[model samples]
Target: MDRAGERSPWPWSTVRRVLATGGVMIAIAGKLLAHDPSATITWNREVSRIVYERCASCHHPGGTSFSLMTYQDAQPRAAAIKASVLSRRMPPWGAVKGFGDFRDDKSLTQEQISLVTAWVEGGAPRGNNPNALPPAPKFGEPRREEIPTSGLAVSGDLTIDRPITVDGLWPEHVPPGASMQIVAAWQNGRVEPLLWLYEYNDSYRHPFRFRRAIEIPAGTTIRGVPRDAKIVLMTADDNSWFSRLRALFRKTG
Candidate 1:
């Protein structure tokens, strides 16, 4: 309304325009807050360690992929890294977490993924102190002699013929981008989860070592594996002296 107004020019259309403008300003303010530089998440403080420990194995100098060893190297690719982790595509562990515990699990925890998201959303700040950064990860040439040549491959459901101590599983022949869930169903009706392959890629295939050895008794049926998908049961010799000693202790005690 103007001071000399006979009839006010204010109308529903003008009101809507003003409201929309206000909304835009509010949205901009929210974005500013979300991208606040002072936010706790920073490359040096949190993300560096995570990347060094988890991603640097492949994303290091002279490694298979591009290096993210320094803040400068990682900052520009922050959004890409965030997207990869959010999609569960980086750290390339393949197995779904919590289904089976593994010693060499490389998948990020939900909290860790959230930290990365917040860091990226907060403008990927490098912390104040450069000295606070963890040491860059080191890599060694993969020893050819250490790689396993063979393992017991099970294609479909298989019943254990004898008690065997299993250390891990290897996805031997799962088609790229295919998924499979393997489980060991005991005769007494206890089902133990073995491994879950989600959108698996053979390029990153490796043995999924269990956190602890699983002693599967005879008659325990390995099930849920697809007919075309072959999973290798990584096992220790049941006749080994260590295994015999453990079995003797189990029987005596």
Candidate 2:
């Protein structure tokens, strides 16, 4: 060895170890810096406009059932919101991929879904920028008033037999499979209207069981309806004629 001389070329193994350690450190740092784009956008601009435009019609205060107005209003229920959005459940309007044109569609855009997911993950921080507040949504121009329509009869009472979430399918995304069945008895108290609600977000003709009407109630035409007086029958997820005609009417409008 030379006097006061230092050493040899670095071995391959040592070089690899050093490189691996550096790579890991770099990865950790990148993760720290890798914030969700939605959060950044929202902090810059009140991105809740996506909600107002795409969702708040039904999911706003004094609306149907839920609200997506503000971060504070949404943060507590962030996880559920995430699940619903990712699954495309909250935007209850159902238009399957490649389906016909829908006039009043409310499915989320890819960017919107990403924004909501990112916001939820980023602690749902409502940025201090005073401008970060979208204008109050106006669900305008109500549809023309139609004649009083009779709701579908629930031949029998049925519950949400299977408990899981569903998704909404779009041009860029396909929802996961979710199957639920509703068992019902006909108004005649004999036939049953078995409704199978699948969440595949695809198109396929499926068969349902409902025997033709035999008799009508006094002063009442035979119609499928919920046995429970409290249950309010409404349209299914999608606005298909099949969904409208073969109704799985329930209070879970």
Candidate 3:
């Protein structure tokens, strides 16, 4: 047996540091923020609400790597957010927008972009809603139909009931220091090898394993790891289809 043990890839400890603690997440968010006042819109409760409706489905917690659920999540990446939206990176979402009609679209309008910009410049204030916004959407089990049977499928005879969506065909912005962990295993004698990597909306990051593969047995209990855990684990690259798509359209648009 492979010992059925757990290991952390990174040389760090497990601690839930706040976002402002000057960690990798904060560092990246700070670098991506912009200083231009003219391009920003004054965001109040209303504006933030709109952003939540249009953007946060995927940007929010558990849907993907980062959570745009709170002001903290969006504030740090304000500049990057503007860049992606202005360039239609946040919403247009296809290798070329207007090429295909998608069920879920996260692209914002010019007005929406302006609104987000102003919100950031206005200090990204959070207006009062006695009840905080609902929790970010949660990911469910991978669905058999959702996985591409043409290219790859889960190993063995096993299948996922909930969908592990893979949005793609274009590029979009992902929050800095966002993290994700996928727990999967080989099935049916590992015929397909059960390769899993990150992709941006552009469907890039193919064969996305930057490091070596994290091999597992046919059935694995430790399918994934968390960012704050002892392991650094794995992350999808900038061009990953899932990363970009999730950032823009909420789901694999």
Candidate 4:
């Protein structure tokens, strides 16, 4: 008789079943590691703020595009939103990052973009707290009066004829789709980056207001503008005779 303590070895079929189960478990673990668990990110907490501040300008109801002003409106489009932000296609600001500092910039930061991606990948959950949502942004009609009347429009390369303080640049005439990089080369060989337009769409034209006014002395050459494209230098000296004359021409001619 066989010893009582001795037991029969496991069958080959049993070992194969165990191996298959382990493989499935490993695959599931790999998938989890591939994406953010998105355990903390939620529509009410973080995403709503980002969308309102950066996107609501054009995406709110009765605005330029479809409404992303509410969680219900945004949840369904989470995937598309993620793609747009990742590709830098939304917010519609054409200026490249790190080239110049501008106020009222609508472009999302890398961290903000990642948060959006994770929120989408994690199933776009609306958090438990509805109160976490920020206040809605106020929309207003475009102020045509605020647009500067006194400025110099330059089509090609231009050398500064006199010392002037530049406040900002407005892309006065950008082709439907064009890429241009404009720079200011100083007399001392310092090249300051002004603006870079990539695949610019003229329909959404707006002035790029600098963080602070830049004082450009005489002899600085504004270069890199395409002969076909025109950008206006919005200067601080609105009382200059040249500016007054140009404004007069714009009104009359």
TM-score of 2: 0.42
Which runs in model 2 stand beyond 4 Å of their true positions? 1-46, 139-253
Question: Could you tell me how far off, in angstroms, the CA of residue 252 lies in candidate 1 after the best superposition?
Answer: 34
Which runs of model 4 end up more than 4 angstroms from their true locations?
1-38, 138-145, 239-253
Q: What is the C-alpha lDDT profile of model 4 across 1-253, one tens digit per residue?
A: 1378765487778888999999999999888865445456889888999998898888887787899998899999998999999988887887888987798778899889988998898899999988888889989884352666667777778777667777889987888879888888898999988899888886448888899888887777888888788788888665653644333222110
- Tell me the tens digit of each residue's lDDT in model 2 across 136-222: 766655344232133232333432222211111111122345343333333345532223334634431111212222222222221
- Tell me which of candidates 2 and 3 scores higher on lDDT: 2
Candidate that beats the other on TM-score, 2 or 4, i.e. the better one: 4
In terms of lDDT, model 1 sits at: 0.81
TM-score rank order: 4, 1, 2, 3
Report model 3's TM-score to 2 decimal places: 0.36
Clashes of each: 0, 10, 30, 0
Give the whole-model CA lDDT for all candidates, comma-separated: 0.81, 0.48, 0.42, 0.81
**Candidate 1: where is the Cα deviation over 4 Å?**
1-38, 143-147, 238-253
Q: What ranges in model 3 sit over 4 Å off?
A: 1-44, 95-101, 128-201, 204-253
Number of the candidate with higher lDDT, 1 or 2: 1
Worst 10-residue lDDT window, candidate 1: 244-253
Q: Candidate 1's residue-wise lDDT over 22-67, tens digit each?
A: 9999999999987565667989888999998888988888887999
Q: Candidate 2: give its CA RMSD in angstroms.
A: 14.7
All candidates: TM-score: 0.75, 0.42, 0.36, 0.76
